[model samples]
Target: MRQKLILERTNEIRCELNKVWDITKQYWYPLFECTREDLISFDSNYIMKSKK
Candidate 1:
């Protein structure tokens, strides 16, 4: 019975990790296009130009 409970908890943890992985993939791809330097600071000008 204890082993069954542990297995259920493990499954729950796996499901939660999968959800987080999906969210990370959704947002990470665009940032992957950026140079390492671009992420160093927030730039309002870059954002403004990007909107055009």
Candidate 2:
């Protein structure tokens, strides 16, 4: 995630990482308290893409 965002944002990776981190914490962090089923939410592929 950090790598992808850094690639996209270039020199702004630090700032972009912070923004994404905050947003992720705000919305998804609480899910950590949930059961594995709930936390799974779909799959890791949601955050990944096919590499060339």
TM-scores of the models, in the given order?
0.33, 0.23
Q: Residue 46 in candidate 2 has what lDDT?
A: 52
> Over the stretch 1-52, how does candidate 2's per-residue lDDT look in tens digits?
3445446477587568545544344344445443333345555575566442
Lowest summed lDDT across 10 adjacent residues in model 2 is found at 30-39
Point out the worst 10-residue segment of candidate 1 by lDDT.
32-41
- Candidate 2 residue 5 Cα shift, in angstroms, is 14
Give one digit per residue, the lDDT tens place, for model 1 in 1-52.
3455588898898679656544244344345443333344367898999999
